[model samples]
Target: MTAITQLSPRLLWQFFDTLCSIPHPSGHEAAVRQWITDWAQERGLVTIQDTIGNLIIRKAPTPGMEQRTGVILQAHMDMVPQANADVDHDFTKDPIQPYIEDGWVRARGTTLGADNGIGLAACLAVLADDKVQHGPLEVLLTVDEESGMTGAFGLAPGMLQGKILLNTDSEQDGDVYMGCAGGVDANITLPYQAESVPSDHQALRLNISGLRGGHSGININEGRASANKLLAELLNEINKLQAGIRLSEVSGGTLRNAIAREASALLTLPKSANPALAELITARQQQYQQEFNGVDDFIDLELVSADLPQRVMTSDLQQKLTQALLACPHGMMAASRDIADVVESSSNLGVINTETEHIYVQCLIRSLNDTGRDRVANATAAVFNLAGADCEFDGAYPGWQPDPQSAIMQLVLNTHKELFDLVPNVKVIHAGLECGLFKAIYPEWDMVSFGPTIQGAHSPDERVHIEAVSRFWQLLVRVLRQIPEDKAASFK
Candidate 1:
């Protein structure tokens, strides 16, 4: 057992500790899936894997509760792979080193994977514990939720027999989420011509780091900076002042759903302009610090020597790309009129990458309505389109429309009041949850998302509250026991 197993609710922590030892980044969950399957089989529980790698593990109801409404506990198996710029960690093969600190579980300079991992572990704990009473239970573990939500999108009908779904992906501990924003990915491809480097040019790498890049959805309205957007703004400023600089490469961000924290660009400039470039970079760094202020206080901009490349983007292409990036829409676009202080629509300039043939730019557009989502997506594409780039949109998922009258939501509310002697906060979130897609397959299923308190999700600063996990587990167990029996006895 790891040191974290010593925490309260040891089973959940033990499972989570084991999960950290296995690499299960988005689209790379085969090892964890197999581990879960083997663990279930050893316990004699029934397990099934769907076509797209979603796992469904079933456990019979506790005695005398067999006739209750079947309930599904859902969480994703894959986690967002993020590490600090200075952390030497390979998410594909290396284990995440988790340690307890200040009453929370945090990974060392990498994402802790507790966003849904804790929920997944909670399900495992319930399955392994024979003392808890519950109705017919099924645990649905989806894959690739971070990258594209492949498992949720590809889930077919009739896979689950549950009438109520409890999503274990929400980050807030004292709240329940009934609705979430729908999303679509905007991919822009800008093909550019490469030209030989200008004579007597010096190559220098420009880096922007130490900015707090958070989950594009939950943290979109937080006024955080996107590294891709910042880098483009800096490069655009340089273009306005110095015409002698040629861009060789520019890239920032990793996943399309994460606000970029770091960005770097390689460019060649006339040797005589080196001193002027340094001065410009310093000025821009200070300007950004002042702009971000308390939100992103430690934004660092650095310029360093880089190996010279034989070719660079043509001056015209560089200018066009930088201009398009500057015009690209990011951050919160509109606020919800129905729910005060709720984000209704937003766009995140999530990622930018350079290739041999073209530069790929990805943006995630989210809104409460499909029309709004498409509007932002089209607007984002139009900016790149005007720059002579081709734009394509895909991976569209619908929003979970709010259902305040849902029985499950009421039960959760009542359960929280009984457990903590306080009413829980109920609201709709701007983040995308798989509950919306699950509705398409199981239209009659009532769904609600709740989880332990997690901070800094989708970033290296991610951490989960220790006490909240224990309380969340208690609530989950009690809710299962209190699931009203179905008069029809829906389970087969």
Candidate 2:
């Protein structure tokens, strides 16, 4: 076992250290779930685990705070599993290696899991603390937040009694997220037909990697390069050069919500055009670097000679795929006309793959409003149809419309200002949150989200700012103590 040094908010550190010792990857959170149950059992706390492994632990109000209202502290239990390719970390069994570096706590070569883990730790720390002054509290921890929101979606109605919900899942500190964008997955599959290989052709592989990829929701508007798009652009350039190349195989991107960081294509080209093809690809790489100099400094493109045992995509299909992807709109499509810093709608060309029988592409569409989301989805499907690619739209989750005048919102704002002597920044986030699901299930519940500063979530670059934990801890306690016992509310 690696020794972990305790940090501020001693209970928080203790809980965080214990959390890191368990393997809690998305869709595989049995060990962590059992650990949490065991911890609650040992404490003799009132706890309940739902059918889908959503745990709810209720803590009675402190003596002086009994008059205050009930508050639900919510956070997802699962973390996105990511690690450096060179690392031998196993998501199913190996414990996360967490250590302090430069003012942040991070995992060695793997995702830090600070995204929701810290929120989970904070809830546990508050639950275990006997001295913290607060009203009735219920800590709600759901599973599979990374891969899907199954646990959240499966939450039974009336499972929680708190009228006010404080979701500790935001990444930025000092900011209160009142609303978030709704998103849907666009899954596509294209049939493949093999063509005869030319005897004068040579196989080559093209790769685009080392781009600074981030969470597709938060970083989608940053103008950072997308590996899927870059690869398609490269192929389009090759096609434009009239290189007689047949696409063999192509695949890129991992998670739907994460920007593609790497992509590769296997192709066969005429041996006679190999020299010219090499020069053209080299020039294209240089041009791409210059074009993305402002955002992607580490981007790299490489081509290697290879031997192919069988043909991949037919020439006609290759041209169609290239044109389809080139036409797909990526990055920020429109900025909000009302809010100064809000992104109204965006699309992420998340994944592209070429299989033995078909070409596949997946896109994630997000918008602050349902109308805009549908428009983006329809536009994307039209692009694929034009290129002879089949498309399918999965059920989309709804966005949480912000309620600025909610009673709980004012209470939190007042408490925040009193505790920190500064007003917290309240706004809607472009990313998807489980709050939307919760709202769907319980329409009357009032909700708001806030958290410590966590950088690079859902990627190996994830880290938790050490200093923000204490402040977050204090803020949570303050908000709990200030909630009014009785409040009437209505949905607008």
Candidate 3:
């Protein structure tokens, strides 16, 4: 057993350690799902799999606690698969090699999957141990939460019997989340005309790297630079110089929910323009460094020689696409008036790629209300549409509105204060959570999201605090036992 399995909360850490051995990246969850089902069955818990592949496990109430309101512990089953550009690890076949660093547990060269893995571990720990007090309980493990909230969106009505849900997905250890932002995916496709590269032109690749690309929703307000936008800006500057550069290919970012950290472009230009292009790259890199000073510590730009490509995008197409990319808005757009110091609306220019017939772009827009989200979505679409690209919005989900008079929220607040001698922060997150979707399906269900302190989520730098997990478990255990009985109906 690893040292992590020997943490204070042994069962939770052990389960998390085992999870690190499995490959459960978004949309490829069968192996991990089957493992969880088999493990639950071995423990004799009642397990059910919904049509959308969401898993539900049930445990009867503790003897005298049967009269309390039924509670559901919720978390997602998938993790975002991200790695540093130089990391050679394959997420599908290799285990995430986790090790202790200072006081946190982190993977060697890839994402640690602790965002929901720790939450899932907590649920399993509760199920396997009978010592914890609770009323009727259900554990809901949803799928594909990182790429898309497919499991939550397709959740059928009346599948769960819980009136209260405790979401274990929030990242901050001492904060209790009451609401979250809604989101939509804006997909843009631009068809381009291609022509044979001139025989006299030489090929060069412009590479952008070393930016701290983080969660598009959580870190969008931090003023981090987007590699896609940076590349487009550089290309636009090149066009102004009348350098006769022809774009052959461009690609950036990995997931739609992560800010573009790295991007590269291939181009063909006359050998005579090489020296000027090199000088321009160095000057642009220095400008970016000064502009993004403390936010993105390392901003690198390089021009390297490459083999000439057979075809290049028509000059008109190249100019139009780069201009559209530059015009698309990114980062925080507005601050919330209702909640102090919180972002109300934002968008991320998450991804861009060149394909054989066309180039594709993806942007994620987030807002606490439908109007703000649609406004940003419309503006983004308008930019690309004017450039002759087709735009479509998909997988839109509603935001969770806060309830001022929630009984469970008060109960959680009181329980935490009593147990820890410190009141937890009751706040709303700008990031999208499945709880918002759950609110639509089960409007009467009172929900709260809480978890341990996780830093650098949705990136290779992801890690979880060791001390925070113990405290998180303590709070969850106490809250489960203090749940009040239902006054309107008799407990089943």
TM-score per candidate, in order?
0.98, 0.95, 0.98
lDDT tens readout by residue for model 1, 347-436? 999889999899999999999998889889888888998999999999999999999778888888889999999889998999999999
- Which tens-of-lDDT digit does each residue in 1-492 have in candidate 3? 577998869999999999899999999888999999999999889999999999999999999999899999998999989999999988888888889989999998789999899999999999988999999999999999999999999999899998999999999988998999999999999996899998889999999999888888888888889999899899898888787888999999999999988999998999888888988999998899899999887999999889999899999998999899999989899999999978999999989999888999999999999999999999999999999999999999999999877778888888888988988999999999999999999998989889999988888889999999999999999989988787233222
Model 2 CA deviation exceeding 4 Å by range:
1-4, 488-492
Question: On a 0 to 100 scale, what is the lDDT of residue 12 in model 1?
Answer: 92
Pick out the ten consecutive residues of candidate 3 with the lowest summed lDDT.
Answer: 483-492
Worst 10 residues of 1 by lDDT: 483-492
Error of 1 at 489 (Å): 13
Superposition error at 60 for model 1 (Å): 0.5
Predictions in order: lDDT: 0.92, 0.84, 0.92
